[model samples]
Target chain A: MNKKINWQYAMMASAFLILALVPLFMSNNYYITILNQMVINMIVVFGLNFITGLAGQMNLGTAGIYALGAYTSALLSRNFGLSPWLTMVAALVVGFLIGRGLGYPSLKMKGVYLSLTTLAFSEIIRILATNLMDITGGTQGIKNIPRFRVLFWNLDTNVKYFYFVWTVAVLLCLLSMRIAHSKWGREFKAVKDNVEAIESLGLDIKKIKIRAFTLAAVYGALGGALYAHFNQFVTSLSFTTDLSISYVIMLMIGGIGNILGNIIGAIVITILPEMLRFLGDYYQITFCTMVLLCAVFLPNGLVSLPGRFRHLVKKKGKGGERFGQ
Target chain B: MEKKRYLSITLAMCLALSALAGCGGGQTPQPSQTQAAGNTKEESQQAGTAGESSNDTAEGASGETILIGVSGSITGAAPINGLRTKQGAQMAADEINEAGGVLGRQIELFVADDGGAQDTAINAANLIISQDVVAQVGPNLSGMALAVEGLLSQAKVPMLTGATSPKLVTTIDNPYLFRIRAADTVQAKLAATYATQNLGCRKLGLFTNSNDYGSGALNVIQEYLDGIGTAYVAEAHNTGDTDMTSQILKLKDAGVDGVIIWTDDAETALAARQFHDLGLDVPIIGSPSISTPQVSGLCQPQWLDNWYCVTDFTASNTSDHVTKFVKDFEAKYNETPELYAATYYGSIYILKDAIERAGTTESDALLKALNETDNLQGVVGKYKPNTMREMVHEGIICKLEDGTAVYLDSITVED
Candidate 1:
């Protein structure tokens, strides 16, 4: 999976270049905040791609996984006065536990049943977050969580935070790509495409499924930790079933199992709503309409638009039936 | 196939790149969106006053008018709260502008809708902060207020909101916020004192929806009841709980003489109906939520026979200014204005008073003027900042006669 001077690598290079140069031209921190949020979403989507995108498991408990990470990081750092970096490790461990916890249900159930199990798990977390007033501060949420600080460096400003999150996101993305392209990646896809074939070949389907779930949860928890520190606040209400579904939407609206598509999906979905803010009360409705259009037209997401056009053009040249595969 | 991959990858990122382009160009006002910005409220949507566009952070740079940003949950779970804030603030701005604008400039109210979401609320706050508003008001709920208070303090823009939770002042020690509504500590005491002194009840049963808002009030009421050496029982239910009868029945089994209910509008109405149906006939005192049109539209008239609520503003008040407000608000919005409307409406005038007194729209000067606010009359109550910068300390306790809140007594918490 080593990269040459290829177009895909070129695209990644230019995208990062554009991001690095964005704040130079734009002085406003609001846009920088949105960029930072996109980076966080990207990391979560990277995690989500493992189970829901690559492995063909529909996991909908992202908010619960995320909240656990955020709360773990926020509470540990703020309450115990631990370094944020140390608490982030704690968040990952919490994520691993949650992944293992929910991984059990994925094995016991499949499809809609598995979805419901994860949804219930997420809701249980939210309810606990809301009710455990002493711990999570109930619905009022924990605010004033301090920003990241090293020996002398403090990522306090929006621009500084964006770069830190972006660096982490890029490093995490490369790691996820490595895993997704590894031998294990093929087995995960094999488990999705034909579990019977993999099982007959003596490959442990249980390990594959659990590993996918764990990877997804781990990514989600890290995203949550980044979010908690970025906003310097954590509210239970912020993480809802809607949030879980949005990540799934990011997966579908990007090409499923496509790494590059996931980033595109997260960026488009997250910032699209903000762009539609000009519509006032109707902005959400308009955004839903746009997403529906994308879903209906590009079933494989925006990543397939070029191939779709090429396919359509070749059919026309052959005087073939329109939309003929 | 490789060429196709290259083309597709470039095309794909171009999509995201254009989105980034959209962000860079976001400050420019889109003419197509301008018409959509005007809502279908009333002829009240007249003149230059729809300056309240939630996304108009870009336009206020002209500085012709004194731009004041407002943040509210206009599109999310509790949209009514945000709408009421918008309507109330709009009316105040219109009145101020009509009476020859503040500081020789019209007060342009720019509203940023948070949709009851903390992240969106933060975005709204940042947009407001970037808009260079002299001062800001309202992201009405306590959670939204606390989330944005630090930003307001950091930006040095004073904010006034109708948040009732005492935690807004107590939890975060931010000096930028001034709570426009009576804190729950004052309101809870009023409900308890009104029950014990006015209704002449001995034992109090605490029935509450066990959410953040409900439990916060529950703790305060429990502390007050405990201080008074009153025997009490407690029962709780979820926010959207269907059958609250078990909780009510538990209170009844305790043989409590009076019940203090802390919950939101819909559930409070449900509880009141259940209390009536279950024959728990002692005085039923409720939090401020029950005094609004939300509860009135839900419960039947007779169900409120023995019901009382501690509130900051009631429509039935016969005070000269309040009636005038009630009449004007009803005429303009074609509905009874809730406490949110009243507080935000008064908030605009309060800012006007501050600007006029301070003689400058600068942040520090206006903040100083707001901090020095004395018995300044507001539609809800008098405007006077306590030590915590909470504006209103007194709350009106009202009993429902026939679906109308009949004001009984005004309880003031001594600082």
Candidate 2:
């Protein structure tokens, strides 16, 4: 078991090392920018994984939380000239409060009702962002958002932003991983599988559910803050219902109850559309087809591919020997 | 068993890495592939000669090709606008290339779809900039233009778009950005002026949608009406709103002599139909949307009678330039050129003129040439950039007569 854990750590380290060296070989700002975006998506998905994956709560309000974080940080930074770091803290606090406020009220409603509430929350945020012209700049959106700066190093370029975003993403991943492995993580999962069982265990399922939501909101806001600083712009159009759905799709495709699955899913889903861009009008159709295929064939998600592949390989090996003899 | 699991995982990682590497490799071959497939023999020979002369004259100006990036919504909501813009820009590029190209070099256009979203627009802008294009043509929506203005300014690439927001050029103060369409404020003012001065409207009823585009137009029209001292009653509706019965009743109860509608095509049609159903015979003035084929087609022919719209382009106008543009656009795309198509088509020509006058694709030179633009004729109108980088200031008010939008009067605002 210890050896297996060591192997997993080694794999993770190598994977990260490769990512770190990518900018050295790939110098195109376009690809690097896409990478930065992918990392931001991963960070958001990691937070979302806690609620939808571990705690078994569907969060369709991610885009709303994301917009709140972005608008809060952008308004603060643009209006008061606050540091990016300071705005990020403010965003996290706002996200936590909103998530708690939302989670507490909706906890009694399960499944589709909760989903509808979250969806309504997202639409409400978008409408506010659209109508609040004085503060949110209406649909024209807020521009010239200050980039992330650290001492003398300004993260103005994509390469610099790549490091900044990935650094945040890695830290968030570590934090999420820690939570996933803790006693609280087990309780969250217990609530997911059977709320009655968790209640019988004397755990306050409501508190655990709200806590999951709060943690997810923190990650979502952190991702949003990083995104606003990196893109250096924020618009209500950036936080549509489509984005919320895509985040849910990424979490599902990456696999529920798996940390690495979130990262892999985010990367694939983000990069796939870009890769298929050359297909012109057919790209969206092809992308949806591929996603549908993945969902149908890989029921456990892409994270289970390795285990499935190994099982198939062993079966094939036995069949080959039988046929040869 | 553990070993097999480890091997499979390692293999999966390798496959993923290779897939990423494949994407990188895929991009490098595109330019060469297009060069091989898209260039004519004569053009290739000219490019070779131009390449040598360019290298001798300047370090970076000798390339045989100049790429202008075009970004807009080729898919998702409002794709019709994007499609028209793209077709118009492509038509311009093709025409230029046919006419010996610009400055002895072929024009290459890299078009990306923004999906009409802010984040996608940013990505498209970054992608286009990475190609080292001299300028960009779109991200056609106002919201999209605002989102990408920062990135384009950072790259020092000039962008000419049809987004009607005045802030695209004014509030942002990004010199690299220019607009080919008249701003919404200008359109609103024209509507207001025509409603009062030409139609003899004293008490006006203003009906507008609630979105940024609609509300922005509403505010400008309100300010203009106030300036003219015309008493007005105003009502707002949401974008997807189908019922305007209550609002229409209010306007009729107020006994307004004229009505100005600022909304999208579908909503405009709905309101017009509702007004006719209610037997309100007041002269109605609408923003550009009511003049669109989609909206005009939806209403009864007589329902649209005496209705006027302040539009950027009226294809039925008798100008020789517009006639030719309409003819050529139909010949090429088999569709009538709308305001979006006309404006984007004019933007490419305007950019081409700038590039030719500057004799180089350098950002500063192109900007200077653009700023000095004077009365260049195109499909939209005579192009002349004001101090605020607004290229087109003229709008035509077309009235619906006998089921067609006929040219009524031309209004040009002086800043």
How well is each residue in A1-325 modelled by candidate 2, as lDDT tens digits? 6654554454555455567777988987778887888889999999999899999988899999999999889889989999988999999999999879887855789999899888899899988888788788878888778988879999878898898887877787788878998987998899889988877878888799899989888889888888888877788878888999999889878887677778778878988877766655666788899989998998677877866888999999999999999
* Number of the predicted model whose DockQ against the real structure is largest: 1
Per-candidate DockQ versus the true complex?
0.45, 0.42
Q: Write the per-residue lDDT of candidate 1 for residues B240-352, one digit (tens) a residue.
A: 58898788888899999999998877888888889999999888898998888867668898888888999999988889999999899888778898888998999998888
Predicted structure 1, TM vs. truth: 0.93
Clashing pairs in 2: none
Worst 10 residues of 2 chain B by lDDT: B51-60
Docking class of 2: acceptable
DockQ result, candidate 1: 0.45
Off by over 4 Å in 1: A1-9, A320-325, B1-19, B27-61
